[model samples]
Target: MKRIITVESVTEGHPDKLADLISDSVLDECLAQDKRSRVACEVMLTKGKVLIAGEITTTAKVNYIEVAKATIREVGYETEDIDFECRIHTQSPDIKHGVDNPLEIRNKENTIEKDIYDMLGAGDQGIVYGYAVNETQNLMPLCVNMANAITERLTFWRKNKTVKGLMPDGKSQVSLSYDGDQLSGIVSIIVSTQHIAETDLNELREQIKSRLINDVFPEYDLSRTEILINTAGSFICGGFDADTGLTGRKTQVDTYGGIARFGGGAFSGKDPSKVDRSGAYMARYIARQVVTKGFAAACEIAISYAIGKAQPTALDVVVFGECKLSVAQIKQYIIENFDLRPAAIIATLDLYNQKYKPTAAGGHFGRPGFFWET
Candidate 1:
C-alpha cells in the first residue's frame, strides 16, 4: 500500500513570519539587556501599519516601534510605515508570581538536580509534544525537510540577487509519496512568490523551475514532477499589504509540519522560563537523544505541566514498539539522565542566549548547532 503526505514552509517575509520575527526581535531586545525579562509580546502588521501589542516586564529600555519596523526592513519590506502603535506593558504579576514560585511534584521524591528543578512552576499550563523519526537523517519527515530547503533557498536567492525579481515573501510545499514507509517519489513542487511588478511571469516560472526545483528537489525522483508556480496568479500583493499578521501564527511551519503532534503551544515571543518555548525545545532534545542512541526508530514524547510548578505533571513516551527496551524502562532512564524543569531546560539548552530571529523564520527542529537539534 502507498501513502502520500505533504508539508509546507514560508519565507521570512511572509506576513505571519514577519509578525513572528518582530515579536521575537522584541523578545531578543529584552533578553539582551535583562536576562530575567518576562515577555509575551504579540505583533500585528497590515498595509502601512504595524501594531505591537502584548505584555513585557524587563529592566531593558526598548523602543518598540523601532524594533518592529527594523524587523520588517530586515525581511525586505520597504514600505513606508507612517502609523505604528505600541500597546506593550509589563507582564501580568499574577502570572509572574506563579512562575517565580511554582514547585509542585509527584510522590515528593526525586534525584534530579533540585537547585534548578525545584520550586519552578511551568510558566503556563499546557501540553507539549516532541517527536523524532528515522525517516530522514535529521529525524524529520522527508517532505518537511524538502519543503524547508526549497523555501530557504528561495530566500537565499532573493537576498543574494542570484535569482532575478524574487522577493522575500514566498512559500514552498512538497508532496511526497511513500510505499509502506519506504520512499517512493515526489508528486509535485509548489512555489508562491512575491516579485517585481514589471517582471515577465512566463520567464519567471522558467527561471524558478531551472534554479529552485532542479537544485532543491533532487532528493527524490522527479520524473513525473508537476511544478506549479504562483497558482493564484501574480503575488505582487503580499507582505503586510495583502494581509494582517500575528505572532505564533506559524507553529506548524515552526515544528514538524504535522508529521508529529503539537501540544497546542507556540514558541515565539516567550522567554525560556515559559514552558511553551523551553519545554518544547527540551522535548525535542529528548526525542532526538532517544533516536540517536538507537533506542527507537521513532519516538514521541508528551509532557504536561501546571502553572507555578517546576515538575512535570505527566510524561508519556511512545516509541512505536521498535525498541528492545520497555517503555517503562526507557522512561526510567530519561528520569535519571535529563532534567525537564523549566530552569534546568533553560540551562541545558542555553535557550536564553539564542539568536531568535533565525529561529523565527526557519523550521526550528532540524537545524544544526541549535541545542535542541544536538
Candidate 2:
C-alpha cells in the first residue's frame, strides 16, 4: 500500500516559536545560575505585547523583560515593536513537597531503597513517546527532517542576505509518498515566508526555488515534485505583529512531526524535572539506541509516570518492519537496563546543565550536540 506523510517546521521568527525561544532562554538563564533551579517558564506573544508567566524555584536573578527582548531582537524583530510583562512566581509548595519527598518514600514503601534516584518524584503525570527510524541519517523521519532543513535554510538565507527582502517568519512543509516502509518519491513542497513590503512574490519564489530548495535537497529528484511558494500571495506582516504565540503550541513540530505518536506535552520552558520534558527525552534516547544497535529498523517507545511517584507506571515498545527481538523481550531489556525514574533520567542525560534556547525553535529530537540525540 502507498501512503503519504507530511511534516512541517517554522522559523524562529514565527510567533509561537518566538514564545518558545523566550521561554527556553529564561530556563537556560535560571539553570546557568542555579543548576538546582526548578523552572516552568511560559511565554505568550501578540501584537505590541509579550507576557511571561510561569512557576519557578530558583536563586537566579533574571531580568525577564530583558531576556524576552533580547531573544526577540536576536530573531530579527525590533524591541520597539513590543512591550513586555512578567508574572513569574515560585513553584507551588505542594508540588515541591512531592518532588522533595516522593510518594515512594512518604508511603514507606521504598524507604529502604537507598538509591538517591528514588527520591525525586515525577513533577507531573503524563505519557511520553519516543521514536526512531533507519530512513534518515539522524534516525528521524525523512519528511520532518527535510521540512526542518527547509526552514533552517530559509533562516540562513534571510540572515546571510542571500534572499533579498526576506524576513524572519517562515514555514516549510514536505510531503512524501511511501511504498509501505520504503519511500517512493517526493509528493510536494510548500513554503510560506514573510518578507519586506518591497519584495515581489514571483521573484521571491524563483529565488527560493533556485537558492533554498535546490541547495537543501540536492540529493532528491524534484523534477516531478510540486513546489508551492507563498501560495497566499504577499506576507508583508508576520511574527507577533500578525499572530498570537503561546509556549508549547508547536508540540508536533518539536517532536516527530506527527509521524510517530506523541503524548501532547510541550517541551519548551519546562525543566527536566517535569517528566513531560525529561521522560520524553529518555524515551527518544531509548528508541534511538534500539535502532542504532540493530534491534529494529524502526522503534517507538512509551513511558508513562504518575505525579509524586518515582517509578514509571507503565513502559511499552513497538518495533516496526523487522526486529531481532520480540517487543516483549525488548521491553524487558529496557526495564532491566534503563532507569526510568525522574532523578535517574535527569542524571543520565545531564539535562540541567545543557542549553535549551536552541531547541525552542527547531524540532528537538534529531538535533546534533544534544545529549539525548547522542
Candidate 3:
C-alpha cells in the first residue's frame, strides 16, 4: 500500500504570520539603515494590543511603534478593527566582556564596536536541517506546493476583489497520495478562511471552489477529493482579534512543513550572528546546489554548532539513499567548496542587509528571488 503525505500553509494575515512579519520588518529596517546592526526582536499580538520586546544593538534610531503599526496596516488590518498599536517594553543591555577590545577607530572616529565578525557565534546552540528534493520542479515537496498555491490564490482573490468580503486570515491543508515513490493523486483539501460576517457560506464555498481550488489543481479529480471550507461556521472576526500570536511559533510552516526533521530553532527575531538563522539559509543554499548539480535525487544537510564558537561542531549530509556519490564524498565536497562558518554564511548569503519580511509567509525556502542571488 502506498503512503500519503500532507503539508499545510497559513495566509500572510494569520496571527502567527503577522507576528513574524512584524519582527522581520523591524529587522529589515534596522539592517537597511545599519548593515552591521546586531538585532534580536520579538513581536506579540492579541486583541487590540501589540507588544514589542527583545535585545537590539544598532546605530539607527527607529520609531519601533510606528514600524509595528505600519506592518499591521499593510497586512489588511486597519485601526478600526481592534487597534493593533505597539509598546516597547525593553532594550538590550551593553555587553561587559573585557577580553575583547572596547573601542576602535573607523573613519578617524573612535567608537565602541563588537569586532567579532569572522564567524557569527551561535546565539543559542541547536540543530537545523536544509532539504531539497527533485519531486517537484522547484525542488519542494508537492504537498507544500498545493498548500502554497491555495494560500497564494486566496491572497490574490482578496487583492483583486474577485472574492469580496474575504478577510485576510486563512489556512490551507493538502494531502497527496503517492504510489511507491511517484505522486498518484490528491487525497483532500481543507481551507479555513475568515470572511465578513454577512457573507453567505454557500456562495463563498462555491466561489472558492471555482476561483481558488479549481484554478490551482486543474488535473486533480475534485469530485472525489474531499473539500471543506469553514466547515464549522462563519468567521466574522479574525487576525489578531480572533487569537493571540507570538514570533517564532510557526517554524514548521516557515521551513519544510514537517516533511523533514527540524532543528528546533526559530528564524525570526534573531540576527544573522545566530546560526539558527544564517546557518539554515546556508544549508538550504548548499542543499539546493547539490540537488541542482545532480549529485542526489534529494539532500538534507545538517550542521551543529557550539555557543560562542566560530565553527560548526559537526557537518553531515543525507541523500535519502539516492546519491551518485558516497555520503563521505558529498560531505567532503560541501566542506571543501562551501564556507560553513556562521559569519561566513551570513556574509556569503548577504543576510545582514537583506530584507526578510517578505519571506515570513508562503514558505521561505522555496521562494524565488531570494536576496542571496542578487
Candidate 4:
C-alpha cells in the first residue's frame, strides 16, 4: 500500500504565532541592547489577557507589556468583537535562577554576584535536533513546503490588502500521497481561516482556491484535491480570543513539520545559552551542510550538554538509511568542523542579535536566507 504523508502550518496571526512573536520580540529587544543578555521568556494568551512570564538576565530593560500589545495589534486583533485585548501579566519567576548565572560562570568569574552581573550561561540543559532532507528543491519535504507556501501567500495578500476581509488567524495542512519514494499526488488540503463577520464563505473559499492555491500548485490537478476552508465554520473571533497560546507549542512547525523526529525541546523564548535552542540551530546548520555536500538523502543531528558545561555530553548523527559516507565519518566531520558549545553556536549563527521575531512564523529552517543577517 502506498503511504500518505501530511504537514500543517499556522498563519502569523494565529494565537500561537502571536505568543511566539511576543517572546521573540522580547528576545530581540534584549539582544539589541545587550548581546550578552540571557533570556528565556514565555507568553500565554487568552481573551483580553496576555500573560508574560519567564526568566531573564540582561542589562537591557524590556517593557514586556509593550511588546505583547504591539505584537497583538500587528496581527490585526484590534477589533472590539474579538475577546482578547492583549493585556499582559507577570513572568514566571521559578526559571529565573540559571538566567541569573550558572555554577560554571560563577566558578570561572570568581563569585555568583560577578557571574550574575557579568556573563551568563544556558538557562537549562537538554538535547536538541536539527534535520534536512532532499525530498524537495528547498531541502525540505513537499507537504511542509506547500503548507508554508499557503501561509506565506495568505500573509502577503493580507498585508497588501489584495484579499480583503481576510483575518490574520489561519492554518494550512497538506497531505501528500507517496508511492514508494516518489510523490504521486496531493491527498488533501485543509485550511481554517478567520474572516470579517459579514464576509461570504463561498466567495472566500473560491478566492483562496482560485488565487493562492491554484496559482501555487499548477502542475497538480486540484479538481481531485480535498480543499477545506473553515471546516468548523466562520472563524470570526480568533487569535488570543478563541484559544490560549504559549511559546514553543509549535516546535514541530518551527522545524521539519513532523517529517523528522523532534528532540522534544521548544526553541522560542529561550536564549542561546540553552542547548535546546543553540544546539538545535547548530544541528540544522550541520545537517544542511551535510545534505548540500551530497552526503545523505536526509540527516538528523542530535547533541546534549550538561548544565554549565562547554562540551556536549553526547553527539550523534543519523542519515535515515541514506548515508553516502559512514555515520561515524559524518560524526567525525561535525566534531572537527562545527562548534557545539552554547556560546559558540550563538556566535556562529549570530543568534545574539535581534532576529527572533521573523522566525516566529513560517518554517524556520527552509527559508531562503538568514533573517538575522538581513
2 against 4, candidate with superior lDDT = 2
Pairs with steric clashes in candidate 1: 102-121, 102-308, 102-309, 120-310, 121-308, 121-309, 121-310
Give the C-alpha miss distance for residue 185 in model 4, angstroms: 1.1
Per-residue lDDT tens digits for candidate 2, residues 1-374, read 99999999999999999999999999999999999899999999999999999999999999989999999999999988577899999999999999888888888764465668879999989999999999889999989989999999999889998878989999999999999888889999999999999998899999899878998889989999999999999999999889999999999999999999998579899998999999999999999999998899999999999889999999989999889999988998898889999999999999978999989877888989899999
> Each prediction's TM-score against the native?
0.95, 0.98, 0.90, 0.88
Cα distance off (Å), candidate 4, residue 218: 1.7
Q: Evaluate model 3: give its lDDT.
A: 0.79
Ranked by TM-score, top first: 2, 1, 3, 4
User: What's the ranking of the predictions by lDDT, best on top?
Assistant: 2, 1, 3, 4
Runs with alpha carbons beyond 4 Å of true place in candidate 3 = 80-119, 372-374
Candidate 3 per-residue lDDT over residues 223-282, each given as its tens digit: 778888888789888998889989998988888888877687888866687777888888
Q: Candidate 2, 271: how far from true, in Å? A: 0.8
Model 4 C-alpha RMSD vs. true structure (Å) is: 4.0
Top candidate (lDDT): 2
Candidate 2 residue 195 C-alpha distance from true site, Å: 0.4
Best-performing candidate as measured by TM-score = 2
* Residues 217-255, model 4: lDDT tens digits: 988987778998888888888777788888889988898
lDDT of 2: 0.92
After superposition, candidate 4 runs with Cα above 4 Å error: 79-122, 371-374
Instruction: Give a tens-digit lDDT track for model 1, residues 1-374.
Output: 79888899999999999998988899999999999889989988888888899989999999989898788788888757448989988777888778875655332446554454666678899999898888789998778888999889889989999878888789999888888767788888899999989879888888889878888865556779888999988888888888888899888899988878887879888888889888888888999988888898889989998888888989999996378677898799789999888988988988878877778988778888787888
The worst-scoring run of ten residues by lDDT in candidate 3 lies at 96-105
Q: Compare candidates 1 and 2 on lDDT and give the better one.
A: 2
